[model samples]
Target: MTQVIRAYVGSLLGFLLLDALWLGFIAKDNYTQAMEGLMRDKVHIWPWIVFYTLYCMAMVYLVIRPQFNAEKASGVFIGGGVLGAAAYGAYNMTNYALLADWPLGISLQDWVWGAVVTSLSSYCGWRLARR
Candidate 1:
């Protein structure tokens, strides 16, 4: 239980930090330009909280726990990368398909970012759990 908690915390923190960098700085201009009129002037706080919480929970349960249990060091990152790719791909592809204004560039960028960020976060979670 303690290990799980530790893993979750580490994963959440890592994810938040990396995502903050991506959304707040690195990809800000791209997102603003891509989203255009669709973005809210003031962001909603609750959705972010809920998303981060649930996403990290899924990461822990589906990726971290199994890797940790199996003592597989590399699987955490690989699994996380795969998971991120799948999740982000689904969302981005859906938007591209449904939304006329959705850009393929944005979807591609997000897929890459998601894979990198989630891979690192999963590694962090595994590290914390191991200790």
Candidate 2:
């Protein structure tokens, strides 16, 4: 029970930090251009809050826990990356398929970022929880 709490908190922090870096510094321009008119003038906080909460939970449960249980750090990292790629790719690809004028560039970049960020975050969380 304690492990689960620690994992959730650690992964949440990790995910937020990494995502902030990616969204705020690295891919800000790309998102702005891609979203263009599709974006709301004012950012809505609720959806993002919900997204991160759910995402971190899923990351910890589905990716980190199994690896932690198996005592495999490498597996945590690799599985996190794969899971991130698959999850984000599903969202992006579905948007591209369903939404008119969705930018392929944004989707591709997001897929890459998702894999990298999730891998690092999950690893950090697993390490912290293990300690």
lDDT of 2 at 24: 95
Question: Global lDDT of each model?
Answer: 0.91, 0.87
> Residue-wise lDDT of candidate 1 within 7-101, one digit each (tens)?
99999999999999999999999989988977888989999899899989989998899987666678988999999999888989999999988
Regions of model 1 farther than 4 Å from truth: 69-72
In candidate 2 the C-alpha lDDT for residue 53 amounts to 92
* Clashes found in each candidate (C-alpha, N, C closer than 3 A): 0, 0
Scored by lDDT, the top model is 1
Candidate 2 structure quality by residue, lDDT tens digits, 1-131: 78877888888899999899888988899899888978888899999899889988898899888877675688988988998999899999999999998889999999888898889888878977787
Give me the runs in candidate 2 sitting further than 4 Å from their true place: 69-72
Model 2 residue 31 CA deviation (Å) reads: 1.1
Candidate 1, residue 113: how far the Cα is off, in Å:
1.0
Instruction: Provide the global lDDT of candidate 2 against the true structure.
Output: 0.87
